[model samples]
Target: MWDHCPLMLMRKNFVSFHVNLVFFQVEDAQGREATIQRLADSIAGPFVYSVMTLSAITFGFWYYFGSHIFPDVLLNDIAGSEGDPLLLSLKLAVDVLVVSCPCALGLATPTAILVGTSLGARQGLLIRGGDVLERLASVDHVMLDKTGTLTEGKPAVSAIMSLACEELEILQIAAAVEKTASHPIAHAIISKAESLNLSIPVTRGQLAEPGSGTMAEVNGLLVAVGKLKWVQERFQQKTDLSDLTTLEQSVMHKSLQDSQSSNHSTTVVFVGREGEGVIGAISISDKLREDAECTIRSLQHKGIETILLSGDREEAVATLAKTVGIKDKFVNASLTPQQKSAAISGLQALGHRVAMVGDGINDAPSLALADVGIALQVEGQETAASNAASIVLLGNRLSQVLDALDLARATMAKVHQNLSWAVAYNVVAIPIAAGVLLPNSDFAMTPSLSGIQELSGYGTQKVTSVDLVKLEMTDFDVILGMDWLYSAMPQSTAEIELSSFSSQMSLF
Candidate 1:
């Protein structure tokens, strides 16, 4: 927690003479709902109050004076009995004040948002605010990064092409230099070296180039492990592998031995030494998520354009795109974070709302730039993607994206319903309370009746239709949600549940 963020105690729990307290505050939060409600209150508050006062005065004068002037038309048993004109006027004026409540207009949105956000929190969805929810509901194009998103983010070493160098030596140096990198491919190389029981050397002054690779000093020698072009530039050598020597005895280099059965999806990186030039190439492969294709299908079925963004080989990205049902034209490969952000901006410029989803540092810029950013939560890793994103999925399930879309849609629906009802009630209730129906139907609203109806609307909003329903227990759960869960946007597409982080402006 930052020094500025002081926790405001909400509640405390007891266990074995120990106290565990949970502290969270969502009031006065700055988001779509809060902004809209404040705006609505500023204008609607005075407007309703002024209108009520004016209407009361108008009705009061008409009853007190007009009753005597036109007894046959005004003096009726509908509202007030034949009594002192001042007393009769006072009762009707008070009725006008009671009927014109600011709740239906002001309270509608905030209340709905509160319920929606709280429900999302309990379900493991940390939605940032009503603004993120509104934007998520409007996203027509979903841009998903390949690693840790479309794929499992668990790459494994498949082949190593050493040029006149021992395979184990190449792997050892590659793993040693790549040890400082956090990328899944780096993990793959290091894990392979460890499985082979190779003694890995420590490196210092590591420089990581996003979407390219890493370079470091290993035992006084500057070695580079990444893309061929980048590694060649770091080694000051030529980027050419066509003039490589024969490798006829290797079984792991099946792509070279039997070209017919080669895996095209494998990502290959060059390993180079300070003076040895390009020494070898390490090939790695990560499998696509089991739900990747289905999740893409679901988005497509709901009329969302699923686009693939990756910093991998074009062929690999295109192949994954084909498998996941995203069109070839929508696939962006070998792109850095800036390029990814440009891709999002381009789509946004074209008036298409884009939602970027990823789980790496490279995806952070695009995630924050998109209309809504969705990030997957890796249990142990504190990812930059999670920090920048507006929505974070706790589990490694692709379908959670759709679940989030569903939640956004559902939450907005509740907001619209509340606002609509509030507007309609004000429109009808105010007119009737002003004695608009007294002339023809002999019906007039009383102060007590106006108060009852206004209070009923609020009472009805307190409970959900499925409130207090029983469900079987599966696992232990504890949750806290504050005022959130509201949006006024049109939600006709898919939505999901997500929780937000620092963007929430809880003053505690």
Candidate 2:
């Protein structure tokens, strides 16, 4: 009754082809009817029909030979009748083909990655994919290089000293001479002048030398502002040093001492009647971020280890770290870029997952070398590092790092939940597929048994022999991804929670 079964196979293949076409059509029908209709029309065309007919014919031939001709041939061979040995080999080959398909492993891994990446996007952290997220979550320690990372990149005048003049007068003269300069020290002087509401007198023929203070005519006075050395040198060249007072000597001595201690290449000024006597000096240094202490403490509470890596002096780095509550485990005092990368690699080699957060070109190599790299957006030097980083913080606030860490932890948790559900499904479905509990009279597992058996045998059975039937009853509900998580919750609320928790700890 089953002989000449090409029509039956054709009917089965026709149904399968339509079922797949319908499944794709439904998925593609994302509020776009015209596009979906075009896709559906393509699936119903001659090319699809031809492929289905060919597949049906191939399946029919394999079934016919397996149930009839091959078995008869094997039996005749055992009974010593003349039968084809090649026919038995072909039948065995067909039987093996019927039991193994390659779709299972091919479909599973990519699907898992897709789901993981989609979930990560919902958390406001866009990782390239699951592989990147997995790598980010595993970071055990973070090396935050100083300079632009821990402090404002710009330097401003923090302190100023004067003797024979008001502080505002000293700032005004300094700002007038330093106005045309682009150096950080110059900016600091100008900023001080602005804050004090000091009017900078416009200077004519302003000249600035590397080690010499800037010289300008402010209100027709030869105004000079820089190191005492430059001022004294210019002064002695044209003045009578024998007439200098004790108080002038003391002020100049203190200015010299400050210059040496600061290690700042100083520029001194000689303000006189057509350049005869020296007047004053101004010093500048880089400013630390106002929220540095708060940011450091927040990082500690999240269980993220922090280390400062910098090219600044050991004393300076230590002082800042101590002020910010960061520990003494930091690297300080003029580290080369190669040394930074080596340090990161060393930590990684010891089985510590290191994240290097930086905002400088000097950090690019180390950022690339670390397990996870984070770059802040506001720093211009961060461009190269940002490109290399697995994550880029859009704002200058270190609190954003805390935000990302929270989101990453949340994303990872969701990944675990998804993995657990997927594993559980397989564990429960596999046994029922193998008929482990079907014989028990207490529970009738038979109705579910057929579906489970078919699912389990998906790759084990011939792709053509397995009925391509849709089992809507067995489909699991859609699991939430990271996008859904973000839309459902308030990010501001999360930030507030983090802030409150941080205050309670005071670890920073």
Candidate 3:
């Protein structure tokens, strides 16, 4: 009895297992079919309307005109008695008119550009429009100089050593006077003060001398901060004839001459009290960004040739470029804005699309000349460059350059996809329109021609719709504009996410 009971339980368990397997198999098969059906429906939904509209227009023309008017026109007496030479000519003219290129030249190029620009914007790269974006993407060689493009434009006080007074006190007084000035040097001074946690006194009155420094009233003291010569001159005017020793007079006189020559090259800050002598001097230097080397390598990895053009001395430019691992090409030693422009034009004349990245007033001309001009966000001439440039990188980080390049490449790929679709559609449709596959073919124009006509119209209409979506994404309502996103994320992640989002939005 026990043996029989065990056998019955085993048989019951086997039957239950078999029943569950059958149920699951049925459910799995149904789920798979449902998935396939959903996919088909989703794809067919948009295309159905496209095909229907195209078919209606094509058939309407063929039935109302092709069947009624065209054959009659072909057989008319005006056709020279159904075979006259003049009538044949007239018929040919009509056929030619009907087949005249429907692809509007004015509309096609602009539409492509509109699509490309929208795609670029979605990738966190704000391109002005079609003309500029096309030109930028086509660029081959890029010339990027180290200084401001690959370095922080703000030159900090690297080593503020005091010659006469307390170093911190000198920085504090200078920062106070500079608080009222708008020069880069002034900003560097204030930044240094803040870093040192020194409290700078509020300025009462301030006056800036172009190419020199500034003079101001801080905490009820007449503080003059400028080149040594200017400060010495101010002190000389206020002091008596014998206030200074012979050595002091000689040093002051020599400093003034040197100041005049060095004014264009170096920035020197001299701080002193009213009717008194010089206290201390602070020298600041612009340092390259920490990631400049890595950024250059990233560009090289993408097969883009990097070159540097700078107004700085040749030795300095070479040193900087080499430090950043970009030593193959560099033009140095104080190039004028026109010279920079000429260099860009010359490179472009060689059939290379040149991209110039710069951050100075002198760089504006070159930026305009280059195929694609990129300006760093903190650059002093960012506004002018941004207006002229095809792209603008908004951040102090040099690595942002790599991000911009990746975005450009991806945007170009999307443009290529669009171009390919346009060409492929034409290749397949033109032969059918010419009636190439007509006689003795069951698979005739009735189905495929209708499909072609519908597809073309559908594509054209969808382009317009997609363009609107792109415009909304690119031209989103915001003050800071597209830069906010690029500023917030790493260049790589931002670009990848942007590309994915754009592709999805375009339904590519």
Candidate 4:
């Protein structure tokens, strides 16, 4: 019996602590692996290795050929006793080593990433590191999770079709039963009741079935609020509910046809009691983010393929895809977490680099599997979705994702520019240190040649860092200057309320 009930077994065996400890250890390992993976993917690591290899080759080549190729340059500079061919060769090799400075290569990617992420943060986009930016720049496909990525994730009561009682009365009973439930649908019903200032009856002996519905005793009667099938299963065990089932089919059909008013996808929850039959049905809908369509179109315009994946009903998912301008072939519906991960893997198998965007726990696995995972920020510390993601959007708007993509591309372009300059500097300076340009170059000592190369590397470092800072500072000044120009515009009340509510949730 204890084995069947894990909670009971935990209390009896004292093994729960060990289990939890092991679970945490796995989580820690995953975090460390993700960090290490990002560091390995960064541009600086490869540049360092390349520069070191080239430096070694430069040393060997100059050491062997200094006497033959630069006989004029070396003989003129040799001192009395230490001026042998071998010593002069050694001196040229040392100059070559010092001139091939890796300082510029070391600082190139990291500085650009720092400036880019700081700018991104100011605009509510959180770039995890240079690796994520690098991935973002090359991603050709984007997999968007429907619920919180495209839709608001907040369900609202769209319609109330009451059969056996007044709509208000049915809502009061349903809200009372759902008050103790933590589901999003439950919260929507409760919020509707509160907004109407309805007085709810007391509830007792409440029980909630995850992903299905909730049941509770209200006004001395067992009131259930859930899917039609779950309610029918519970009610049919005690009494016949054929009439209620027929009524539910009618209500559901009606709700589906009324998609114009409800918009997007809507879920119907049956409210009823045993023996008394079905009383009413509540139609709840999740609204699409106001900018979702525009954002999708923008991504499409950039030639990036956009795909929608959701666990929602197929019809609803199709409707959303159509509304957002995504092709029918690219929309996938009714996928489990494992299926979502498989879809990402399949895309990658086809040679497409995928970026997964989501904001829920169900998305965590797919987020981890994608080449780049971007979590839409909800008001919280850190979600499992965010932990698995390489990029996170701190703002609620879908448009912010576009901003992040643009910033990442720009940052990468800057990184390439810095690296090109660094490589070119080494190419030209190493040969000079090897005495190729020594006949025409006005360098009296080996120290002077190395000093010029070191100064050039230091100058490149200062220029790269300073240029980014100036660019970001200039953007800030422009925004501050234009604040008054936009201040007189009226704001949407709905958007204002939603933004404030989102901000408040983030604080906690």
Candidate 5:
């Protein structure tokens, strides 16, 4: 609730922002079409109209024919006054109409949605609505974000290249100077220093320039940490830093090698002290999560195509893709946010239902544009991504993506089952109640049976018109417990083994 306060304020402002605009045409079309769509989508919609029509036909039939047929039955069984034929016919027709409960039809899907969402919440998956589940069941392709989604967002310090100075001294000065910056690389250095239990010294006159670097006076020395270009530019501006050019060249040479390694791409940060020249460079790289590879494989085995979409360099994206077992053709690299959105649109144009998983500001537009948008709710995730997403992955696990797909398909199946049963019940029983077989004495059904059929379809007895009253609150939870959906997923995903059953239940 607290997390959504900003969005609530935005909505409040947005409402007032658009108050002066005339949207008559759009609103009219939306009003008419939305109403029609809502009515169509309601589980009991068709059934209710069918029941009304059947009730009128039943009334007309008995009103014309009851006088002849019911008189014989009542005379044979009763000793008291026989009610007027018209009144008896009207009563039977009303009974038939009233007992055909649309409430059960309405309650069926909503109940499942409520239970499913609540169950998902417990499992750290925040499904926005049942409509998302409905759409997820049709998704044939999944576009994944490389950072944060597949790999742990946190990058750790890998190696330090020091010039003449011990690596420990370089780290201490860098950590101390970087303490004022909140960049990912800064955090990596600080985290590494803390892991080594090194004390970070207090700095004076600290200044940080966005996209440049951070500089401060530490232990009476002018210490700085940042990108190689920014650090070099800073060095050129300082007369005392003239002697640091050779050291800077050495650090750059080593950092280039560390970055060019085929294993994975790494970010490098340069460190310098005014009087001592260049200190060293620190290498930081994000590591893949434990379940990332397995999750990608699991999704692929289900015949759901997996695509890696990232703004990272092609080499880096390719390395992560290879590590995760994603096909080369599906890997998209160095894409701007708009390009990512365009890719999603392209796939959709090809008649593929797409699900995009991302966790950053750049991914927000594509996330919103995808058929089903899934955002990994990691610590410090951008607000835009979360707001655009239809489903929020609170646990930040790729494996949970599989769980969501399985649950969505299962929930949709339940909806179909419920709706089919309701339609079949009305189709078969309505004719019987209308006395369709009354002329054939051999198989003619009695009035008691008419009432019985209606009530039985409702799965209840003692049903009154009140029981058939439109269910004011048809929404019900379709609880999909972790164990239930988990059991339904491939055993390879559950057991972490290769098996022939992996493709049995594809979400597509």
Candidate 6:
């Protein structure tokens, strides 16, 4: 009950300045359609209207001056003015105003974005907004977090090596130390012990070093389980364990190397005790997601550069990159969460548009920093990485990254097409309304014809009605106008609800 207090709420939120900084940054950036529409509404709209209004005044003055100087030139049969300059000028001014249709210019970008985002929702992508789609279309580099983004985040313990203690003894003690951690590697150790019917001892003074390892007191003995160097540094500092020999260190290094060079790409975690020093190594293997390779290949085929960035060791990062066809120069290993964000920032500083893919909470920083952040959902394991991401794949499929990219490019293509149509419509209509051929042939676009032509742009669809709602849904919600329908809800249920609503309306 004490946990429900308001002061306790700040702990979960504002975990760091970076987290809040990323989440609040949505207001500063606008999507492709939004940018275009903003320019149209704020600047282009007024500018074009002013230009048309001034053109009418200028054309009226020119015709009025011509009526006195060369009356024959001002006489146009279209308006039936009988050489009356005021009537002709007023008629032509109205024609120009009607012909300057700004509807298409406003509607072009937004319509495409709405359809694209809605389609993405149907395909298991919960895109934040149309701006994300625009960013996805522009991504040149894709930075991938190895453990969860590329490989199956779930790892299983395959082998264990020991120097001073038995394998089972090291395993049990390691599990006790790891039970405090929520990491996939920790889960692997704890799960392995559970599978072997070994009960984990209740640990005291359990401590975690994020991205490095964990420590705890098991059976009144201090134990450290994490990276080899991390475990060695802590244990070797203790005077009681100072006598740990150089021969044992060399053997551990050899075993660590051997563990890395296995047929399967594996990560090695060291187990160290207070008195015995570096006692053993645990080799854990995480298989790649089934679609990881194909997705990377497709992105590469589309000329997108792919990079592997992770907190894992260089050997582990390299092995995963090689398996996925990412080049060696593109791989960076042993990065903390902050370093991952810094690497992405460096790439972006070099003018490369980088997209980050991650699945763990540690990935939130980089995911928030990238030009586009794509997060893959992990079943039974959810992280706030999605909260920082621009796109979330709820199906947990890596191939959906490519699906997002393709859809973005295609949607942008549609926007360009719509813009082209708007420009072509304006280009042809304006000159005709301005009465360019009135002197000789009396061929001019009348006010009625101009109104009809302008209506042609907006009559097809109420494009502005496409509400670009700020949707932050984990599951799909298809917003069709004012009605909200869950994509997961059955069709019959929706129909029944709609029928019930209609009956209520009839009774009213």
Q: Which candidate number would show the highest lDDT if scored against the true structure? A: 6
Winner on TM-score (1 vs 3): 1
- Residue-by-residue lDDT tens digits, candidate 1, 368-444: 99999998865434588877988776555677788778767766666667666767777787777766666577676
Better structure of 3 and 5 per lDDT: 5
Give per-residue lDDT, candidate 6, residue 311.
86
- The candidate with the higher lDDT, 1 or 3, is 1
C-alpha lDDT of all candidate models, in order: 0.69, 0.51, 0.54, 0.69, 0.65, 0.71
- Using lDDT as the measure, name the better of candidate 1 and candidate 2: 1
TM-score of 5: 0.63
Candidate 5 CA-lDDT value: 0.65
lDDT of 6 at 267: 74
How far in Å is the alpha carbon of 160 misplaced in model 3?
2.5
CA deviation > 4 Å runs, candidate 6: 1-34, 66-77, 81-84, 237-264, 379-381, 459-508
Our model 4 lands, by Cα RMSD against the true structure, at 11.4
True-structure RMSD for candidate 1: 8.9
Better of 4 and 5 by TM-score: 4
- The count of backbone overlaps in candidate 4 is 0
Question: Which tens-of-lDDT digit does each residue in 1-508 have in candidate 2?
Answer: 7766564433455434533432342223222222222333343354334434443443454345433534443343321354444443343333223222223322223333333333223323334434454566666687887766777656555444554566567778878888988544577778878887887888888887642357778787676665444556554444445333433444445555654343222222333324445543344445566667787898777677888876544656777788788888764544667878888888888999888888766678888898778776552222676667766553455555555565445444544443344344444543332223323421212333434443454322222111111111111112212232234333332234335445644532
> Considering summed lDDT, which 10 consecutive residues are worst modelled in model 2?
467-476
Worst 10 residues of 5 by lDDT: 492-501
lDDT of candidate 5 at residue 400, scale 0 to 100: 77
Residue 345, model 2, lDDT: 84
Off by over 4 Å in 2: 1-128, 157-287, 379-382, 442-508
Q: Which number leads on TM-score? A: 1
Candidate 3 lDDT, tens digit per residue, 1-508? 4655533433455434533443343223222222222333454455445434544454445434443444443343333554343433333333322332233211234334444444444343445444454555566677875546666666666445444568788899899888966556677889989987998888877887643567888778788877556677766534333433332344334444444332112234567777566766666556567677787787778777878876544545666677788764454545656667888888888888888887654566788888878766552233565556656654445665565565445444544554445445545654454333322231223333344463454355335423433332223214335444434333332234345445645753
